[model samples]
Target: MGDLAGRWRELNRAYWDERVPVHLGTAFYGMEGFRARPDSLKGFETAEMGDVRGRSLIHLQCHFGRDTLSWAARGARVTGLDFSPPAIEAASRLATELGLHARFLTSDVYDAVAAVEGEIFDIVYASFGALNWLPDITRWASVVAELLAPGGCLYLAEFHPFSFVLDDETGSRVTHDYFDEGPEASGGPGTYADEAAVTEHNDTVEWRHSLATVVSAIAGAGLRIRFLHEHDHTFYLQRQSLECHDGDIYRHPEGAPRYPLTYSIRAEKA
Candidate 1:
Protein backbone atom coordinates (compact mmCIF):
# COMPACT_ATOMS: atom_id res chain seq x y z
CA MET A 1 0.00 0.00 0.00
CA GLY A 2 2.81 2.39 0.86
CA ASP A 3 4.58 1.67 -2.40
CA LEU A 4 1.38 2.19 -4.36
CA ALA A 5 0.71 5.47 -2.62
CA GLY A 6 4.22 6.72 -3.31
CA ARG A 7 3.95 5.74 -6.96
CA TRP A 8 0.58 7.43 -7.23
CA ARG A 9 1.98 10.63 -5.77
CA GLU A 10 4.86 10.54 -8.23
CA LEU A 11 2.49 10.04 -11.14
CA ASN A 12 0.29 12.91 -10.01
CA ARG A 13 3.26 15.24 -9.65
CA ALA A 14 4.36 14.42 -13.17
CA TYR A 15 0.85 14.79 -14.54
CA TRP A 16 0.32 18.19 -12.99
CA ASP A 17 3.76 19.34 -14.10
CA GLU A 18 2.85 18.51 -17.67
CA ARG A 19 -0.69 19.81 -17.42
CA VAL A 20 0.10 23.27 -16.06
CA PRO A 21 1.37 24.59 -19.37
CA VAL A 22 -1.57 23.13 -21.29
CA HIS A 23 -4.10 24.49 -18.82
CA LEU A 24 -2.60 27.96 -19.09
CA GLY A 25 -3.18 27.94 -22.85
CA THR A 26 -6.76 26.72 -22.60
CA ALA A 27 -9.93 28.84 -22.57
CA PHE A 28 -11.77 26.77 -19.99
CA TYR A 29 -10.08 28.74 -17.20
CA GLY A 30 -11.12 32.01 -18.79
CA MET A 31 -7.83 33.88 -18.26
CA GLU A 32 -9.32 36.84 -20.09
CA GLY A 33 -12.44 36.80 -17.96
CA PHE A 34 -10.31 36.62 -14.86
CA ARG A 35 -8.26 39.58 -16.02
CA ALA A 36 -11.40 41.61 -16.77
CA ARG A 37 -13.08 40.78 -13.47
CA PRO A 38 -10.44 40.09 -10.89
CA ASP A 39 -13.00 39.58 -8.19
CA SER A 40 -15.08 37.11 -10.13
CA LEU A 41 -15.25 33.88 -8.16
CA LYS A 42 -17.18 30.75 -8.93
CA GLY A 43 -20.81 31.38 -7.99
CA PHE A 44 -20.99 28.41 -5.65
CA GLU A 45 -17.84 29.50 -3.83
CA THR A 46 -18.87 33.09 -3.18
CA ALA A 47 -22.48 32.17 -2.46
CA GLU A 48 -21.53 29.51 0.06
CA MET A 49 -18.61 31.39 1.65
CA GLY A 50 -20.40 34.75 1.73
CA ASP A 51 -18.14 37.78 2.24
CA VAL A 52 -14.40 37.77 2.98
CA ARG A 53 -13.94 41.51 3.41
CA GLY A 54 -11.04 41.30 5.86
CA ARG A 55 -9.68 37.84 6.48
CA SER A 56 -6.60 35.75 5.90
CA LEU A 57 -7.14 32.89 3.43
CA ILE A 58 -4.88 29.97 2.53
CA HIS A 59 -5.87 28.17 -0.65
CA LEU A 60 -4.61 24.63 -1.06
CA GLN A 61 -3.93 23.00 -4.43
CA CYS A 62 -4.63 26.36 -5.98
CA HIS A 63 -4.00 25.81 -9.70
CA PHE A 64 -2.59 28.98 -11.26
CA GLY A 65 -4.27 31.18 -8.58
CA ARG A 66 -7.37 32.26 -10.49
CA ASP A 67 -9.60 31.71 -7.47
CA THR A 68 -6.88 32.81 -5.10
CA LEU A 69 -6.60 36.16 -6.85
CA SER A 70 -10.36 36.33 -6.86
CA TRP A 71 -10.36 36.08 -3.08
CA ALA A 72 -7.64 38.72 -2.83
CA ALA A 73 -9.66 41.08 -4.98
CA ARG A 74 -12.52 40.58 -2.55
CA GLY A 75 -10.25 41.92 0.25
CA ALA A 76 -8.88 38.67 1.71
CA ARG A 77 -5.19 38.44 2.45
CA VAL A 78 -4.67 35.46 0.16
CA THR A 79 -1.83 32.95 -0.13
CA GLY A 80 -2.02 30.28 -2.83
CA LEU A 81 -0.13 27.01 -2.55
CA ASP A 82 0.42 24.26 -5.11
CA PHE A 83 2.92 21.46 -5.71
CA SER A 84 3.60 22.28 -9.34
CA PRO A 85 6.31 24.89 -9.90
CA PRO A 86 5.02 25.98 -13.29
CA ALA A 87 1.58 26.56 -11.85
CA ILE A 88 3.02 28.58 -8.99
CA GLU A 89 5.14 30.62 -11.39
CA ALA A 90 2.12 31.37 -13.56
CA ALA A 91 0.05 32.24 -10.51
CA SER A 92 2.69 34.62 -9.21
CA ARG A 93 2.95 36.28 -12.61
CA LEU A 94 -0.81 36.62 -12.85
CA ALA A 95 -1.03 38.17 -9.40
CA THR A 96 1.60 40.70 -10.41
CA GLU A 97 0.07 41.43 -13.81
CA LEU A 98 -3.38 41.97 -12.37
CA GLY A 99 -1.98 44.13 -9.56
CA LEU A 100 -3.84 41.96 -7.05
CA HIS A 101 -2.28 41.45 -3.66
CA ALA A 102 -1.72 37.67 -3.45
CA ARG A 103 1.15 35.48 -2.41
CA PHE A 104 1.91 32.30 -4.38
CA LEU A 105 3.99 29.52 -2.88
CA THR A 106 5.34 26.38 -4.51
CA SER A 107 5.09 23.41 -2.17
CA ASP A 108 3.14 20.25 -1.68
CA VAL A 109 0.19 20.75 0.62
CA TYR A 110 1.77 18.76 3.46
CA ASP A 111 5.14 20.56 3.34
CA ALA A 112 3.55 23.96 2.81
CA VAL A 113 1.75 23.71 6.14
CA ALA A 114 5.00 23.18 7.99
CA ALA A 115 7.09 25.54 5.84
CA VAL A 116 4.70 28.40 6.49
CA GLU A 117 4.56 27.78 10.21
CA GLY A 118 3.74 30.62 12.66
CA GLU A 119 1.07 31.85 10.27
CA ILE A 120 -2.55 30.96 10.82
CA PHE A 121 -5.34 31.76 8.45
CA ASP A 122 -8.94 32.69 9.10
CA ILE A 123 -9.93 30.27 6.37
CA VAL A 124 -8.27 27.26 4.74
CA TYR A 125 -9.85 26.87 1.34
CA ALA A 126 -9.74 24.07 -1.28
CA SER A 127 -12.09 23.42 -4.11
CA PHE A 128 -13.01 21.23 -7.06
CA GLY A 129 -10.79 18.21 -7.78
CA ALA A 130 -8.43 18.91 -4.90
CA LEU A 131 -9.06 16.04 -2.48
CA ASN A 132 -8.70 13.05 -4.78
CA TRP A 133 -5.08 13.81 -5.54
CA LEU A 134 -4.25 13.23 -1.90
CA PRO A 135 -3.38 9.71 -0.80
CA ASP A 136 -4.23 10.31 2.86
CA ILE A 137 -7.30 12.35 3.66
CA THR A 138 -6.45 12.28 7.37
CA ARG A 139 -3.11 13.94 6.72
CA TRP A 140 -4.71 16.47 4.39
CA ALA A 141 -7.35 17.29 6.98
CA SER A 142 -4.70 17.58 9.65
CA VAL A 143 -2.81 20.05 7.47
CA VAL A 144 -5.99 22.07 7.13
CA ALA A 145 -6.57 22.00 10.87
CA GLU A 146 -2.97 22.88 11.66
CA LEU A 147 -2.94 26.13 9.67
CA LEU A 148 -6.37 27.27 10.78
CA ALA A 149 -6.54 29.94 13.46
CA PRO A 150 -8.84 29.60 16.43
CA GLY A 151 -12.41 29.96 15.17
CA GLY A 152 -11.04 29.52 11.67
CA CYS A 153 -12.83 27.31 9.17
CA LEU A 154 -12.08 25.14 6.14
CA TYR A 155 -14.15 25.26 2.96
CA LEU A 156 -14.32 22.64 0.21
CA ALA A 157 -16.37 22.28 -2.91
CA GLU A 158 -15.88 19.04 -4.84
CA PHE A 159 -17.46 16.68 -7.29
CA HIS A 160 -19.65 14.03 -5.69
CA PRO A 161 -18.20 10.54 -5.55
CA PHE A 162 -21.19 9.17 -7.38
CA SER A 163 -20.23 11.25 -10.39
CA PHE A 164 -17.06 9.19 -10.63
CA VAL A 165 -18.97 5.93 -10.81
CA LEU A 166 -20.30 6.45 -14.29
CA ASP A 167 -18.83 4.10 -16.88
CA ASP A 168 -16.84 6.04 -19.45
CA GLU A 169 -15.89 2.97 -21.49
CA THR A 170 -18.47 3.04 -24.24
CA GLY A 171 -21.80 4.08 -22.82
CA SER A 172 -23.03 5.43 -19.48
CA ARG A 173 -23.17 2.51 -17.05
CA VAL A 174 -22.24 1.99 -13.45
CA THR A 175 -18.95 0.06 -13.37
CA HIS A 176 -16.42 1.37 -10.92
CA ASP A 177 -16.90 0.88 -7.20
CA TYR A 178 -17.45 4.11 -5.32
CA PHE A 179 -15.66 2.70 -2.26
CA ASP A 180 -12.72 1.24 -4.14
CA GLU A 181 -9.35 1.94 -2.54
CA GLY A 182 -6.94 1.07 -5.33
CA PRO A 183 -5.44 3.59 -7.71
CA GLU A 184 -7.25 4.31 -10.94
CA ALA A 185 -5.26 5.24 -14.00
CA SER A 186 -6.50 7.35 -16.90
CA GLY A 187 -4.97 8.28 -20.22
CA GLY A 188 -5.51 11.99 -20.61
CA PRO A 189 -8.32 12.23 -23.08
CA GLY A 190 -11.71 13.82 -22.49
CA THR A 191 -10.65 15.99 -19.57
CA TYR A 192 -12.70 18.84 -18.13
CA ALA A 193 -10.58 21.03 -20.37
CA ASP A 194 -11.04 21.09 -24.14
CA GLU A 195 -11.87 17.57 -25.29
CA ALA A 196 -10.59 18.29 -28.75
CA ALA A 197 -6.98 18.85 -27.82
CA VAL A 198 -4.85 15.72 -27.49
CA THR A 199 -2.67 15.76 -24.40
CA GLU A 200 0.95 14.65 -24.51
CA HIS A 201 0.74 12.84 -21.22
CA ASN A 202 -1.17 9.57 -21.33
CA ASP A 203 -1.62 8.53 -17.72
CA THR A 204 -2.59 10.08 -14.38
CA VAL A 205 -3.52 8.62 -11.01
CA GLU A 206 -6.48 9.28 -8.67
CA TRP A 207 -7.86 7.81 -5.48
CA ARG A 208 -11.50 7.11 -4.81
CA HIS A 209 -12.83 8.73 -1.64
CA SER A 210 -16.33 8.25 -0.32
CA LEU A 211 -18.47 10.86 1.40
CA ALA A 212 -18.19 9.09 4.76
CA THR A 213 -14.39 9.05 4.51
CA VAL A 214 -14.31 12.76 3.65
CA VAL A 215 -16.48 13.82 6.59
CA SER A 216 -14.78 11.45 8.98
CA ALA A 217 -11.32 12.68 8.09
CA ILE A 218 -12.17 16.27 8.92
CA ALA A 219 -13.96 15.23 12.11
CA GLY A 220 -10.97 13.17 13.16
CA ALA A 221 -8.80 16.24 12.76
CA GLY A 222 -10.88 17.82 15.59
CA LEU A 223 -12.81 20.20 13.37
CA ARG A 224 -16.52 20.55 13.95
CA ILE A 225 -18.62 20.06 10.89
CA ARG A 226 -20.68 23.12 10.02
CA PHE A 227 -22.66 22.03 6.97
CA LEU A 228 -22.46 19.53 4.10
CA HIS A 229 -24.38 20.79 1.13
CA GLU A 230 -25.08 18.65 -1.95
CA HIS A 231 -26.41 19.87 -5.23
CA ASP A 232 -27.74 18.31 -8.44
CA HIS A 233 -25.87 20.77 -10.63
CA THR A 234 -22.15 20.74 -11.44
CA PHE A 235 -19.85 23.56 -12.49
CA TYR A 236 -18.79 21.78 -15.68
CA LEU A 237 -20.10 19.29 -18.21
CA GLN A 238 -18.64 16.05 -16.92
CA ARG A 239 -20.28 13.62 -19.29
CA GLN A 240 -20.94 13.74 -23.00
CA SER A 241 -24.66 13.23 -22.49
CA LEU A 242 -24.98 15.81 -19.74
CA GLU A 243 -27.14 18.75 -20.75
CA CYS A 244 -25.99 22.26 -20.01
CA HIS A 245 -28.65 24.76 -19.07
CA ASP A 246 -26.59 27.97 -19.14
CA GLY A 247 -23.03 26.75 -19.84
CA ASP A 248 -22.28 27.24 -16.14
CA ILE A 249 -24.05 24.18 -14.77
CA TYR A 250 -24.77 20.72 -16.17
CA ARG A 251 -27.27 18.00 -15.43
CA HIS A 252 -28.13 14.54 -16.78
CA PRO A 253 -30.49 14.28 -19.70
CA GLU A 254 -34.16 13.24 -19.36
CA GLY A 255 -35.02 10.08 -17.41
CA ALA A 256 -31.43 9.68 -16.26
CA PRO A 257 -31.05 8.51 -12.70
CA ARG A 258 -30.51 11.53 -10.51
CA TYR A 259 -27.48 11.73 -8.28
CA PRO A 260 -25.59 14.37 -6.37
CA LEU A 261 -23.26 16.10 -8.81
CA THR A 262 -21.32 18.30 -6.40
CA TYR A 263 -21.02 18.93 -2.68
CA SER A 264 -19.65 21.61 -0.35
CA ILE A 265 -18.63 21.42 3.28
CA ARG A 266 -17.54 23.97 5.88
CA ALA A 267 -15.72 22.74 8.96
CA GLU A 268 -14.56 24.94 11.80
CA LYS A 269 -11.66 24.35 14.15
CA ALA A 270 -12.90 24.08 17.68
Candidate 2:
Protein backbone atom coordinates (compact mmCIF):
# COMPACT_ATOMS: atom_id res chain seq x y z
CA MET A 1 0.00 0.00 0.00
CA GLY A 2 3.05 2.25 0.37
CA ASP A 3 6.71 2.26 -0.64
CA LEU A 4 7.58 0.04 2.31
CA ALA A 5 4.94 -2.51 1.35
CA GLY A 6 6.02 -2.37 -2.28
CA ARG A 7 9.56 -3.20 -1.19
CA TRP A 8 8.30 -6.08 0.91
CA ARG A 9 6.38 -7.46 -2.07
CA GLU A 10 9.52 -7.24 -4.15
CA LEU A 11 11.41 -9.19 -1.51
CA ASN A 12 8.75 -11.88 -1.66
CA ARG A 13 8.69 -11.88 -5.44
CA ALA A 14 12.37 -12.65 -5.56
CA TYR A 15 11.98 -15.39 -2.98
CA TRP A 16 9.13 -16.94 -4.96
CA ASP A 17 11.09 -16.65 -8.18
CA GLU A 18 13.74 -18.75 -6.50
CA ARG A 19 11.22 -21.39 -5.43
CA VAL A 20 9.82 -21.91 -8.96
CA PRO A 21 12.64 -23.92 -10.48
CA VAL A 22 12.97 -26.05 -7.38
CA HIS A 23 9.21 -26.57 -7.11
CA LEU A 24 8.89 -27.75 -10.71
CA GLY A 25 11.30 -30.59 -10.11
CA THR A 26 10.19 -31.67 -6.66
CA ALA A 27 8.03 -34.66 -5.73
CA PHE A 28 5.85 -32.33 -3.65
CA TYR A 29 4.42 -30.67 -6.76
CA GLY A 30 4.25 -34.06 -8.46
CA MET A 31 4.10 -32.50 -11.95
CA GLU A 32 4.38 -35.84 -13.72
CA GLY A 33 1.67 -37.40 -11.56
CA PHE A 34 -0.44 -34.27 -12.13
CA ARG A 35 -0.61 -35.15 -15.83
CA ALA A 36 -2.46 -38.40 -15.22
CA ARG A 37 -4.91 -36.98 -12.69
CA PRO A 38 -5.24 -33.45 -14.02
CA ASP A 39 -7.72 -32.17 -11.44
CA SER A 40 -5.57 -31.96 -8.33
CA LEU A 41 -8.09 -30.22 -6.08
CA LYS A 42 -8.98 -31.82 -2.76
CA GLY A 43 -12.26 -33.63 -2.29
CA PHE A 44 -13.83 -30.86 -0.20
CA GLU A 45 -12.87 -28.14 -2.68
CA THR A 46 -14.63 -29.88 -5.56
CA ALA A 47 -17.71 -30.61 -3.50
CA GLU A 48 -17.98 -27.04 -2.27
CA MET A 49 -17.45 -25.61 -5.75
CA GLY A 50 -19.85 -28.05 -7.40
CA ASP A 51 -20.10 -28.24 -11.20
CA VAL A 52 -18.13 -25.38 -12.78
CA ARG A 53 -18.67 -26.21 -16.41
CA GLY A 54 -18.43 -22.95 -18.45
CA ARG A 55 -18.03 -20.73 -15.41
CA SER A 56 -15.30 -18.10 -15.67
CA LEU A 57 -12.76 -18.68 -12.89
CA ILE A 58 -9.78 -16.54 -11.92
CA HIS A 59 -7.13 -18.04 -9.63
CA LEU A 60 -5.13 -15.49 -7.65
CA GLN A 61 -1.62 -16.33 -6.45
CA CYS A 62 -1.86 -19.39 -8.63
CA HIS A 63 1.64 -20.79 -8.45
CA PHE A 64 2.73 -22.39 -11.72
CA GLY A 65 -0.98 -23.11 -12.49
CA ARG A 66 -1.62 -26.78 -11.75
CA ASP A 67 -4.75 -25.94 -9.77
CA THR A 68 -5.74 -23.32 -12.33
CA LEU A 69 -5.37 -25.75 -15.21
CA SER A 70 -7.19 -28.27 -13.08
CA TRP A 71 -10.15 -25.88 -13.11
CA ALA A 72 -9.78 -25.67 -16.89
CA ALA A 73 -9.87 -29.43 -16.97
CA ARG A 74 -13.23 -29.22 -15.23
CA GLY A 75 -14.62 -27.01 -18.03
CA ALA A 76 -14.25 -23.62 -16.28
CA ARG A 77 -12.83 -20.93 -18.51
CA VAL A 78 -9.76 -20.19 -16.40
CA THR A 79 -7.24 -17.40 -15.93
CA GLY A 80 -4.37 -17.51 -13.44
CA LEU A 81 -2.44 -14.62 -11.88
CA ASP A 82 0.62 -14.31 -9.66
CA PHE A 83 2.96 -11.47 -8.73
CA SER A 84 6.05 -13.35 -9.83
CA PRO A 85 6.67 -13.10 -13.57
CA PRO A 86 8.50 -16.41 -13.60
CA ALA A 87 5.54 -18.16 -11.98
CA ILE A 88 3.17 -16.69 -14.54
CA GLU A 89 5.52 -17.65 -17.36
CA ALA A 90 5.65 -21.21 -16.08
CA ALA A 91 1.87 -21.27 -15.79
CA SER A 92 1.55 -20.10 -19.39
CA ARG A 93 3.95 -22.77 -20.58
CA LEU A 94 2.19 -25.42 -18.54
CA ALA A 95 -1.17 -24.45 -20.05
CA THR A 96 0.31 -24.85 -23.50
CA GLU A 97 1.77 -28.22 -22.54
CA LEU A 98 -1.57 -29.43 -21.20
CA GLY A 99 -3.28 -28.14 -24.34
CA LEU A 100 -5.62 -26.21 -22.08
CA HIS A 101 -6.98 -22.82 -23.18
CA ALA A 102 -6.38 -20.34 -20.38
CA ARG A 103 -4.81 -16.95 -19.74
CA PHE A 104 -1.94 -16.49 -17.33
CA LEU A 105 -1.01 -12.99 -16.15
CA THR A 106 1.59 -11.48 -13.86
CA SER A 107 0.20 -9.05 -11.28
CA ASP A 108 0.22 -8.61 -7.55
CA VAL A 109 -3.08 -9.71 -6.04
CA TYR A 110 -3.65 -6.13 -4.85
CA ASP A 111 -3.60 -4.85 -8.46
CA ALA A 112 -5.52 -7.80 -9.89
CA VAL A 113 -8.53 -5.96 -11.31
CA ALA A 114 -6.46 -3.62 -13.46
CA ALA A 115 -4.06 -6.45 -14.26
CA VAL A 116 -6.92 -8.40 -15.77
CA GLU A 117 -8.00 -5.32 -17.75
CA GLY A 118 -11.15 -4.85 -15.66
CA GLU A 119 -12.62 -8.20 -16.57
CA ILE A 120 -14.89 -9.85 -13.99
CA PHE A 121 -15.27 -13.56 -13.34
CA ASP A 122 -17.99 -15.91 -12.19
CA ILE A 123 -15.60 -17.40 -9.63
CA VAL A 124 -12.63 -15.59 -8.08
CA TYR A 125 -10.48 -18.25 -6.44
CA ALA A 126 -7.34 -18.81 -4.36
CA SER A 127 -6.04 -21.56 -2.12
CA PHE A 128 -3.37 -22.68 0.37
CA GLY A 129 -0.22 -20.60 0.79
CA ALA A 130 -2.01 -17.58 -0.67
CA LEU A 131 -3.57 -15.35 2.00
CA ASN A 132 -0.56 -15.29 4.33
CA TRP A 133 1.72 -13.67 1.72
CA LEU A 134 -0.68 -10.73 1.53
CA PRO A 135 0.04 -7.85 3.90
CA ASP A 136 -3.52 -6.58 3.98
CA ILE A 137 -6.43 -8.97 3.93
CA THR A 138 -8.81 -6.03 3.52
CA ARG A 139 -7.09 -4.94 0.31
CA TRP A 140 -7.07 -8.52 -0.96
CA ALA A 141 -10.78 -8.87 -0.28
CA SER A 142 -11.52 -5.60 -2.05
CA VAL A 143 -9.74 -6.89 -5.12
CA VAL A 144 -11.77 -10.06 -4.95
CA ALA A 145 -14.90 -7.93 -4.72
CA GLU A 146 -13.87 -5.86 -7.75
CA LEU A 147 -13.01 -8.87 -9.87
CA LEU A 148 -16.22 -10.79 -9.28
CA ALA A 149 -19.41 -10.24 -11.27
CA PRO A 150 -22.60 -9.69 -9.30
CA GLY A 151 -23.66 -12.94 -7.66
CA GLY A 152 -20.18 -14.28 -8.27
CA CYS A 153 -18.38 -16.17 -5.52
CA LEU A 154 -14.97 -16.09 -3.82
CA TYR A 155 -13.75 -19.51 -2.82
CA LEU A 156 -10.64 -19.67 -0.63
CA ALA A 157 -8.90 -22.82 0.58
CA GLU A 158 -6.20 -21.91 3.06
CA PHE A 159 -4.14 -23.18 5.96
CA HIS A 160 -5.79 -22.31 9.25
CA PRO A 161 -4.02 -19.60 11.18
CA PHE A 162 -4.36 -21.69 14.31
CA SER A 163 -2.23 -24.29 12.61
CA PHE A 164 0.56 -21.76 12.31
CA VAL A 165 0.62 -20.87 16.00
CA LEU A 166 1.62 -24.43 16.88
CA ASP A 167 5.17 -25.66 16.85
CA ASP A 168 6.49 -26.30 13.34
CA GLU A 169 7.84 -29.81 13.86
CA THR A 170 5.23 -31.52 15.96
CA GLY A 171 2.14 -29.30 16.02
CA SER A 172 2.81 -29.93 19.71
CA ARG A 173 1.84 -26.60 21.21
CA VAL A 174 1.50 -22.88 20.60
CA THR A 175 4.78 -21.25 19.69
CA HIS A 176 3.32 -17.93 18.56
CA ASP A 177 0.36 -15.72 19.20
CA TYR A 178 -2.74 -16.29 17.11
CA PHE A 179 -3.57 -12.57 17.01
CA ASP A 180 -0.22 -11.30 15.79
CA GLU A 181 -0.67 -9.72 12.34
CA GLY A 182 2.87 -9.65 11.21
CA PRO A 183 4.91 -8.67 8.24
CA GLU A 184 7.08 -11.20 10.06
CA ALA A 185 10.46 -11.64 8.47
CA SER A 186 12.21 -14.95 7.86
CA GLY A 187 14.90 -16.11 5.43
CA GLY A 188 17.29 -18.90 4.58
CA PRO A 189 18.01 -21.48 1.85
CA GLY A 190 14.90 -23.52 0.99
CA THR A 191 11.14 -23.52 0.37
CA TYR A 192 8.08 -25.35 1.70
CA ALA A 193 8.00 -27.42 -1.51
CA ASP A 194 11.34 -28.94 -0.73
CA GLU A 195 12.85 -27.79 2.55
CA ALA A 196 16.19 -29.55 2.07
CA ALA A 197 16.72 -28.42 -1.53
CA VAL A 198 19.19 -25.57 -2.05
CA THR A 199 18.13 -22.21 -3.44
CA GLU A 200 19.54 -18.76 -4.26
CA HIS A 201 17.06 -16.22 -2.81
CA ASN A 202 15.35 -16.97 0.48
CA ASP A 203 14.49 -13.75 2.33
CA THR A 204 10.78 -12.89 2.52
CA VAL A 205 8.06 -11.35 4.70
CA GLU A 206 4.69 -12.90 5.51
CA TRP A 207 1.54 -12.11 7.48
CA ARG A 208 -0.84 -14.32 9.37
CA HIS A 209 -4.54 -13.45 8.96
CA SER A 210 -6.68 -15.20 11.54
CA LEU A 211 -9.88 -16.88 10.39
CA ALA A 212 -12.04 -14.12 11.85
CA THR A 213 -9.85 -11.42 10.33
CA VAL A 214 -10.13 -12.96 6.87
CA VAL A 215 -13.88 -13.57 7.04
CA SER A 216 -14.58 -10.10 8.38
CA ALA A 217 -12.53 -8.47 5.64
CA ILE A 218 -14.49 -10.27 2.96
CA ALA A 219 -17.75 -9.34 4.68
CA GLY A 220 -16.69 -5.70 4.96
CA ALA A 221 -16.03 -5.73 1.24
CA GLY A 222 -19.75 -6.53 0.76
CA LEU A 223 -19.49 -10.26 0.23
CA ARG A 224 -22.03 -12.39 2.09
CA ILE A 225 -20.65 -15.28 4.08
CA ARG A 226 -21.98 -18.47 2.61
CA PHE A 227 -20.00 -21.05 4.54
CA LEU A 228 -16.71 -21.44 6.36
CA HIS A 229 -15.49 -25.00 6.65
CA GLU A 230 -12.54 -26.19 8.72
CA HIS A 231 -10.72 -29.42 8.03
CA ASP A 232 -8.59 -31.80 10.08
CA HIS A 233 -6.10 -32.11 7.22
CA THR A 234 -3.96 -29.89 5.01
CA PHE A 235 -2.31 -30.33 1.60
CA TYR A 236 1.35 -29.82 2.47
CA LEU A 237 3.77 -30.80 5.18
CA GLN A 238 3.37 -27.71 7.34
CA ARG A 239 4.46 -29.80 10.29
CA GLN A 240 7.21 -32.44 10.54
CA SER A 241 5.33 -35.44 11.93
CA LEU A 242 2.38 -35.15 9.58
CA GLU A 243 1.66 -38.22 7.48
CA CYS A 244 1.11 -37.82 3.75
CA HIS A 245 -1.78 -39.73 2.31
CA ASP A 246 -3.67 -40.10 -1.01
CA GLY A 247 -0.84 -38.19 -2.70
CA ASP A 248 -0.53 -34.76 -0.96
CA ILE A 249 -3.03 -34.52 1.88
CA TYR A 250 -1.34 -34.57 5.28
CA ARG A 251 -2.71 -35.47 8.68
CA HIS A 252 -1.66 -35.88 12.32
CA PRO A 253 0.15 -39.22 12.42
CA GLU A 254 -2.02 -42.33 13.10
CA GLY A 255 -3.50 -41.80 16.56
CA ALA A 256 -2.05 -38.45 17.57
CA PRO A 257 -4.25 -35.45 18.47
CA ARG A 258 -5.78 -33.39 15.72
CA TYR A 259 -7.17 -29.91 15.30
CA PRO A 260 -8.20 -27.70 12.43
CA LEU A 261 -5.24 -27.66 10.04
CA THR A 262 -6.88 -26.16 6.95
CA TYR A 263 -10.11 -24.42 6.05
CA SER A 264 -12.22 -23.25 3.11
CA ILE A 265 -14.57 -20.31 2.83
CA ARG A 266 -17.21 -19.79 0.16
CA ALA A 267 -18.54 -16.25 0.12
CA GLU A 268 -20.77 -14.59 -2.45
CA LYS A 269 -21.24 -11.06 -3.76
CA ALA A 270 -24.71 -9.87 -2.98
> What is candidate 1's lDDT per residue for 163-191, written digit by digit as tens?
87886532278877878955666547544
The global C-alpha lDDT for each of the candidates, from Candidate 1 onward, is 0.83, 0.90
Look at candidate 2 and give me any clashing residue pairs.
none
Runs in model 1 with CA error above 4 Å? 1-5, 168-172, 189-191, 196-198, 254-256
| lDDT over C-alpha atoms for residue 233 of model 1 | 78
Task: Output the lDDT of residue 260, model 1.
Answer: 83
Total backbone clashes of candidate 2, pairs 3 or more residues apart or in separate chains:
0
TM-score of 1: 0.92
Superposed by TM-score, candidate 2 places the C-alpha of residue 202 at a distance from the truth, in angstroms, of 1.0
- Residue runs of model 2 more than 4 Å from their true location after superposition: 1-6
